[model samples]
Target: MQKFLFELNRNADFQSRYLSDRRDAMNGFDLSDEERHALAEPDIGLLFHLGVNGQILMHFAAFHEIEWQDYLQQMRDGIAAHGPVREGVYAVTGYEGVDAHSSRLSKTSDAEKGS
Candidate 1:
């Protein structure tokens, strides 16, 4: 997905192809059904929960003409509806959430130092 977004951002030919036929543009990539659905549906929120980088996603949203505030709200809504990111560095472990993972790592580090 990141690759697709990156290409969409940088590759004019791909961008033109995507603007013309989204499904066709997506044909070459190994996107999962969910990813394809989100792209096809243009679900910004779901894409966020899928762990698409925000910087990359912003372009996707912009390409779709999504307003900036609306894009932010969609991400928040995705978190509310989907719990946390499901992939990438932001992925939640057991739904503890992204920040919780950092806290867990911190606590583990502190415990190790104490020992």
Candidate 2:
């Protein structure tokens, strides 16, 4: 997927709220045209370290699409591809339950790499 290095905006509450809202929005398949358009839009805000110091890398939006599992995996793969080399990344999603982000690449990986 496309690499987007970004920093956390606001506090953890922002993330909590975003997770909640995103979960609610994705829970069902019934999405309006606007929702579909937004989802289709390539906007992924990424967070990563950019240098030797604690410099923050922030990209407000970088959009992309993939299967839910692959979307999560690309998050990890993007990090591994750019961030510190890590073996695993894990978190719980209210919608998908437990989820993992890893460095595994896929055939369509090239399509998502350019932007």
Candidate 3:
């Protein structure tokens, strides 16, 4: 989990770009049925990416630039009220250098850890 979080920290710029594209599609733009389905599916990795992405995009769209501090607070609030960004995922805090609820864990590891 921490590894994925570190990966996100390093690739924040790329993630921002992805968020921009996703926002465009969500805002009355066209997408193929499959693409729409992909977004709709309950994939934790996708949701995490989207949540981070959407926070940045929404900040820009709503405020004309990234207000990350506020965006983070808003994202946190939204997640708390609604639960995890997607099924089988959660919003974790206090884990250093990691994405909370990282989906990188394998089934074997989960079994070993009894998670």
Better of 2 and 3 by TM-score: 3
lDDT of 1 by residue, 2-35 (tens): 8888988888898899888888899889999999
* Residue 85 CA displacement from its true place in model 3, Å: 0.8
Tens digit of per-residue lDDT, candidate 2, span 3-115: 11121233455345444565343334554454333333422212221121112212223222245555555445545555542221321221111222223244347658865
The 10-residue segment with the lowest total lDDT in model 3: 88-97
CA lDDT, every prediction?
Answer: 0.85, 0.33, 0.42
Report the Cα lDDT for candidate 1. 0.85
Better of 2 and 3 by lDDT: 3
RMSD of each: 4.6, 16.6, 12.0
Q: What is the lDDT of candidate 3?
A: 0.42
Q: Highest lDDT: which candidate?
A: 1
Looking at model 1, the pairs that clash are: none
Give candidate 1's root-mean-square deviation (CA, Å).
4.6
TM-score against truth, every candidate: 0.76, 0.22, 0.28
